[model samples]
Target chain A: MSTPIETDVVIIGAGPVGLFAVFELGLYDLKCHLIDILDRPGGQCAELYPEKPIYDIPAWPEISGQALVDRLMEQIAPFSPEFHFNRMVAGFRKLDNGRFEVETDEGELFHAHAVVIAAGGGSFQPKRPPVPGIDAYEGTSVFYSVRRVEEFRDRDLLIVGGGDSALDWTLNLQPVAKSVTLVHRRPEFRAAPDSVNKMFAMRDEGKVRFEVGQVTGLKGENGQLSAAMVKGPDGEIDIACDRMLPFFGLTMKLGPIADWGLNLHENLVSVDTEKFETSIPGVFAIGDINWYPGKLKLILSGFHEAALMTQAVKRIAHPDQKLVFQYTTSSTSLQKKLGVK
Target chain B: MTKISIVAFDSTRFDVDAENGSTVMENAIRNSVPGIEAECGGACACATCHVYVDDAWSEKVGSPEPMEEDMLDFAFDVRPTSRLSCQIKVRDELDGLVVHVPERQA
Candidate 1:
């Protein structure tokens, strides 16, 4: 409903490739605004393996995934690309003027001359716990992720699952909650060794309760949870709690990107090797989401594709201008734009 | 340089020379070999670069590592000869490496 944020390009997904695209587009004097489902950028690099060492990056022989992302962020700082985080782009339409308008699930809208999809493996959505009727408590008593930690303060919390998220939050919320109880299908955990050990230490110290069971049912009224039925090895038991946090891990789905009408080859956006442009003329696909002959889903490959796509984007965005390729190493205009002088 | 032959599902043959220490997936991308989509680069993350090693080169190509085998689970078709091209590092012994790429990667 509000006036769409106007920009030269709307880049979906703030992953490493999307971040790099900003720099490439900025070199051509095109402004970019990025949208990501996560609260921060770096997609799989940050989410899955932030501390994992990457060996194949061109210049950097060894850099952690998160460190590489941080460097990219610093590199694009001069561009000042606008970032719209914690929002899922749900709607897209091409305007009569050849511009594209995209609306996020949060109701924010963006109008841009070109759209670049750098969404790595699509959108990551939390896998809901298999408990029946858990939907009623999703936004209220039950939560998949701890957005604001303070919201659990002084409340009776029942955290479930056996992953890093569950153990991490159990340790964090124990000191503040009225009582913190962790429920799992088994005593074992797939979380990090240290966190798992700390959780057991807390349980031994009587600071928290560890119940080996599965959450079978919920007892609440009008979206407020009062208790949860746990199916233990012996029998069912009800644990009183005001809040339940279940860390069931996350699954990546193509989400709204699948509905954008682009040709998809096995859930990946199919694009040409030359321009990285999708079936749609003004739309482009890069990074892990693109499919082409001999397409290597490497960050370096995406970087190469981003460079070529930017050339195409510049032509489409500035049709009247004679596009000249300029090397950043020697181009005074580029150095000035990058503020490297 | 090691000569590598990659055959697509349509039986299109691409013969290229790759430097030692490089990967089959890298050489395929460099030579624009069809049906080789190494989407994760060479990270062994995505199994897009799945290939079936030729019977003669099967033992020479070796078996996919545990990590590569795990990733192979996501590939289109699983066979004893299936290997992730990114994990197949080129070496002097692999001078005449031959592999067949699947129709598509899952």
Candidate 2:
């Protein structure tokens, strides 16, 4: 029953498209508040391929993923759009007053005249390792991420994966946990060389056990893990542990957006090419999440959708204001919003 | 065009004529081969397009680069011959290559 934050528009994502929407909406004096599942503004650009170069972005022949997101943030700075990081929009419903109410999994609520779903490929969730029957022990005996270090104090911990998340936690929790076993598919690690060397140093002192293998099976009762069956280079061996943490990286899931009762075409929100508005009025979908006849999931396409969506949003937010479109290059009013006039 | 075959987990074979410079992952998607998600669209980012090289074609297909190897850590049930299909280009040497899709993608 908390008070909802009121705004002109509530953007469901903070990626490149969502960031650009702020610029388009800001030109017409529409305020925006964006919510993202990731801790930062950029979605896939920041998470999946930060350093990976993207060749198709207009004007710039070559730009890295993180660099594109950074530029988008800079472009949208004039809008002063509020960002809610590490939050997922769980509940979405139309209010009786014609405004839309967006709720997060964390219970924060927002009321806006319009909603922009710029969610690209949905939210990035931690990938669950393909070990059989791992779901039963998820909350109790298994954890994909560490929220508190003290939770593993004096417990037998089995850490799996060759990535930095696995190595860093193995080193960090070794002293805190009663016993630590680091298991991987290979001896070669994707983690930093310095951490690998320190891990080897720790293994030499008999403080931690590093095994080259994968957890094939789990033995536990009622979500209480007893031991894990490791298929290693030698053979199937049991590693006794009460807790297990497997870091397999992340995957994109459509998440709660599917439950909003919007017209969907193969898991993507069905929208018109005009304003990119969904079946529900005032609720617009753009970027990769939206589906049209000839829609491309490129950043440029999303940018175009944002510009059109903002014009429609402005009419809804300010019903009495006169509608007049002007270019940022020629219009003093638009330039004033950009703070260049 | 180079010939390549993608064997699904159910053993369904999809033989395709792939263009040179295109990736094995693209050919799988173009032919609608099941079990090859290629979620990242051949960026060598996501490991959903993972495939195991047929024993005979393993040596000719070659091993994954360091970047592709790092991405393979995100894949499920990664075997010794496991490779992200996007990393495998359709070169003439790889003609008549065969790769088996795994049970599930990450």
* Superposed model 2: Cα runs more than 4 Å off: A1-6, A11-122, A254-341
Tell how far residue A289 is off in model 1, in angstroms.
Answer: 4.3
Per-residue lDDT, model 2, residue A297, is: 86
Q: Write the per-residue lDDT of candidate 2 for residues A1-341, one digit (tens) a residue.
A: 67999999999899889999999999999999999999998887776556556778899999977899999898889889999999999999899999999999899999999999999889867789888999999989999877567879999999999987788889989999999999998889998898899999999999999998888889999999999999987889999999999988866577899888899886789999889999998999999889999888899999999999988999999999999989889999889889899
Worst 10 residues of 2 chain A by lDDT: A44-53
Fnat for candidate 2 (0 to 1)? 0.54
Error of 2 at A235 (Å): 2.3
DockQ of each: 0.02, 0.27
DockQ of model 1 vs. true complex: 0.02
Residue-level lDDT of model 1, residues A1-341, one tens digit each, is 87899999999999999999999999999999999988898987886556566888998999977899999999999999999999899999999999999999999989999999999888976667657788999999998767567889999999987777788889878988989999886666767789899999999999999997777789999999999998887788999999999876554578988998999886789999899999999999999889999989799999999999999999999999999898999999999999996
**DockQ of candidate 2, scored on C-alphas against the true complex (2 decimals):** 0.27
